[model samples]
Target: MAKAPVAGGYYPPVGFHFKVEFVGIGNDNDIRFQSVAGLTVEYDTESFKEGGENRFEHKLPLRTKYPDLSLKRGMLTDSKVIKWCLDALQNREFKPAQINVILLNEEHQPLKTWNVYNAWPKKWSVSDLNAQDNSIVIETLELSYNYFTVN
Candidate 1:
C-alpha cells in the first residue's frame, strides 16, 4: 500500500510503522504482527446478452467478495489468538471476531485503519525449519472475513 499524504505537508508514514489488533482477544502477542495481507474486495459480475443485438454483453454487478486475510508473526509458545484459532479449526467450534489493522505515523498515531469483520481462522501454518538458514520461525494465520471497512 502506498503511503497517504499527511497534514502540514508531512511525509507519508512508513509501512513498517503499524499495529494490528484482534478486538477483545486481550493478548499482547495478538497485536504484534510482522505482516498483514489480503484486505481486498472485488465485485462479482454477470454478463447478459440481448437476443436482438450483436453488441457487447452487458455487465451486471453482484455482491462483493472479500478474499481471505493473512497475518504473520514470530512463533510464540502461547497465545490466546492461537488458542481461539485452534478451537475453531481443531475442535470444530467456530467463533468469529473483529480485527483492526492500523497504519501509524512517526508519532505512532493512526493514519488509516482497516476494520475486518466476522473473521475466523481458516488456516494456520508455521515456517519451514531449515538448519542451514538462520531466521526466526514465523507463524501465518489465514482467516476468512465477511468484509472490511477502510477509514
Candidate 2:
C-alpha cells in the first residue's frame, strides 16, 4: 500500500497553500481554482404570506445579500486557519466556487481535506466539531486545512 506523504501527521511551514480542480456533475465544468482563500459568493433567501381577513399579511419576493461564504470551527480559536484562508483567496491565484484545503497538524503534516462549495459553509461552520481522531488535540495548534479548487 502506498502511503500518502503528508497524511496521518502534521507538515511544515504551518502556513501552506495549494489549489485543485473542482470536478462536478453537469456542464458547469468550466469552474477552476488556483488557490484556496478569501473567495466570495452570494446566498438566496425567501419569505411567504399566510392568513387573511383584513390585516393578516407578510412580505414576499424578498432578497438580500450576504458574504460569499463563512467558516467556523470549534477545533481552534487562534484564527490561524481563518487568516491562512483569507490570504489564499486574496492572492489572485484562485477563483470562486473552486478551492482546495490542505489540513496540517502541529508538526506541519497533512491531516484531511475537502472541496468547498457555495453551500459548504452551512455544513462545515458547525458550532462544535466531533472529530473522532485522538492522536492530536482538537483545539490545539495542530490539524489545519488548506482549501482550494481546480479548473
Candidate 3:
C-alpha cells in the first residue's frame, strides 16, 4: 500500500481582511464595502423510512437556506447604499443585485470568491451616538439573497 502525501509547513489563509462588491441593477458601478459578515449557506435533509430497511436510515437532500448577509462599516457621506435600500422600500418594482465577497491572501490578492445572486437589501441601520464615548459612526446593511456560490 502507498501512503498519501502530507503537506509540511503549510499554513491556511486567514479571514481577517476581505473586500465586498455590489453589482447589477441599482448599482451601475461596483461598490466596495469595508466589512462583511453572515455569509453562510445551509441545507435541510429529508429522511425516508423503508419497510424492510435495516438499522440504517436513508436520507435525501431537501430545501436549501441562505442566511441574510450583514455588512458594516464606518459611516460615509456616500448615499449609494442608502439609496438602494430606499428604492427597494419605496419603489414598487425593485431590482435585485449581485454581491461578491472576495477573500484576500497576505499579498492582498484574491484567494477565494463568493457570489451572491438576486440580493436585495432587507434592513438598514446606524449605530447610536454617545455623548461621552468617542467612536466613529457605523452603518449596517442587511441583505437577503436567493443563493450564493463559492469559487
Candidate 4:
C-alpha cells in the first residue's frame, strides 16, 4: 500500500508568515515586516575570445553581486530598528548588523532561513500621508550586505 499524499507539511510555505530579525539590534516587534525583497545573488560574467574557436566565446564568472535588501513594515514611533537606520543615514555613523529572514510554518517553526551578513542600512523612507485615503504609514528600510547564506 502507498502512503497518503497529504502529510503533516505544506508543499510551499506561505510567504506572509515569515519574520525578519535584525541581529543584535531592535526589540521583538522590529522583526515583523510586511515584505522582504532583494534576496538575490547574481554572478557577474566576463567573456573573452577563444584562441582557435570561430563561433563562440567562453564566459567566466568574475564575482558575485548582491542587491540591497528591502524591508517594509508599518511605521512605529518607537523602534530601535529605526534608530539604527537613522544613525547611519542621518548621522553617518555606520555599523554592520546581521539580518535573518525566516520562513515559518503554521506552527511558527522556521521552515527556511536566509542569513544576511554585514548588513547596514543604505536608505530609509516612509509612505506619504494622505487625508483623502486611509492607510497605514509604511516604513521601508533598504540594507546593503556583503553576502547571504541559506539554511
Candidate 5:
C-alpha cells in the first residue's frame, strides 16, 4: 500500500475577512456592513498594600470595561443605520441590539464568533467627499454596549 504525505501545521486565520450581524432591531434585515472594528475588553486592577507587608503588593480585579465598538462601511442609499441613530437622537428612544462579529476561515466557514449585547449607537459620522479622489463614500457608526462574550 502506498503512503500519503502528512499535512503540515495549522495556519492562523486571516483578520480581514469577517461578517457582522445586527439582531433585535426593526428594519435590520438589510444591515450589511463592510468592516467592524474596536473590539476590546479590559479590566481595572486595584492594588492594596498592607501595614506590615514586606514588599509585595496585592493586586485585585476592580472592574471590567468594554470599549465602544465601531462599524464602518460604504454609504448605502437606504441608510438604515443612519436612520436608527437619528431615531435615538430625535425620539430619545434607544433600542438595544445584539451585534455578532464572526471571523471566517479561508473556506468561508465560521471560525470564531463574538456576541455584543445591549448595544446602541453612540455616534455616527460620514466621510468627506472629494472630486479628485475616486473613493466610495464611507460611513462610520460607533456603538456603546454593556458587555460582550466570545464563543
Candidate 6:
C-alpha cells in the first residue's frame, strides 16, 4: 500500500478530497437542515492554502457547537464524521434535500449511492466523478443539531 500522508488519519496528501451532498437525515433527529443544500466537499488539508498545519476542521456550520459523542475526549474521530453525514441526510429530522454519494477508488471507479430525504432532486444527477485516481470521493452531508440538545 502506498504510504498515505496522515492528516489526523483522514489522508491529507493534497489530493484526497471527497465531494459530497446532503439528502436529509433520519426522522427521529431531523431539524431544518440548511447545511446540506448545495454541493460541499471534505478535504484532508492541514492548511487552507498549503505548508501550514492547522488540521482539517469542518467547513460547514454544524447545528451543535459540540457533539454528543459519548466519548471522553480526544480528536474528532472518523466515525463522528460518518455519523454526522448519516444524520444530515434524513428529511424527517433534518430539512428536505436529495443526497447522492459518489465514491472513487485509487483506480478511479465511481461507486454511487443515492439517499433521498423527502425527495430526490430532479436536477441533481449523478455520473462518473473521477478525481484523476489520486484520491477517493466520499459523499456525505454536513448538519447541525436542534440547537438545544447539543453537548
Runs in model 5 lying further than 4 Å from the true structure? 1-8, 26-32, 54-56
lDDT of model 2 at residue 96?
A: 28
> Lowest-scoring 10 consecutive residues by lDDT in candidate 2?
25-34
**Backbone clashes under 3 angstroms, per model:** 0, 24, 0, 0, 0, 13
Please list all clashing residue pairs in model 4, or write none if there are none: none
Model 2's TM-score against the true structure: 0.24
Off by over 4 Å in 4: 1-4, 7-10
RMSD of each: 4.1, 15.5, 6.0, 3.2, 3.8, 17.3
Model 1: CA > 4 A from native: 1-10, 51-55
What value of lDDT does candidate 2 attain over all alpha carbons? 0.36
lDDT, candidate 1, 1-151, per-residue tens:
6667768867655889888888988387678989999988899999999898797898899999999999899988889999999999999889899999999987688999999999999999999999999999999999999999999
* Model 6 misplaced regions, further than 4 Å: 1-17, 22-95, 112-116, 119-151
Write the number of the candidate with greater TM-score, choosing between 1 and 4.
4
- Tell me the whole-model lDDT of each prediction, alpha carbons only: 0.91, 0.36, 0.78, 0.93, 0.81, 0.33
Candidate 1, after superposition: displacement of residue 144 in Å?
Answer: 0.6
The predicted structure with the larger TM-score, 2 or 4, is: 4
**Tens digits of per-residue lDDT for model 2, 1-151:** 6646886585454444332323341132212212244443334545355656445455454443334333322344344333343444455322224334445565445555555543221222323344774442232111122333422
* Candidate 1 TM-score, true structure as reference: 0.87
| Top candidate when judged by lDDT against the true structure | 4
Residue-by-residue lDDT tens digits, candidate 5, 75-149? 776756577777886788898788888898877788999999999989888899899999999888899999998
State the number of backbone clashes in model 3.
0
TM-score of 4: 0.92
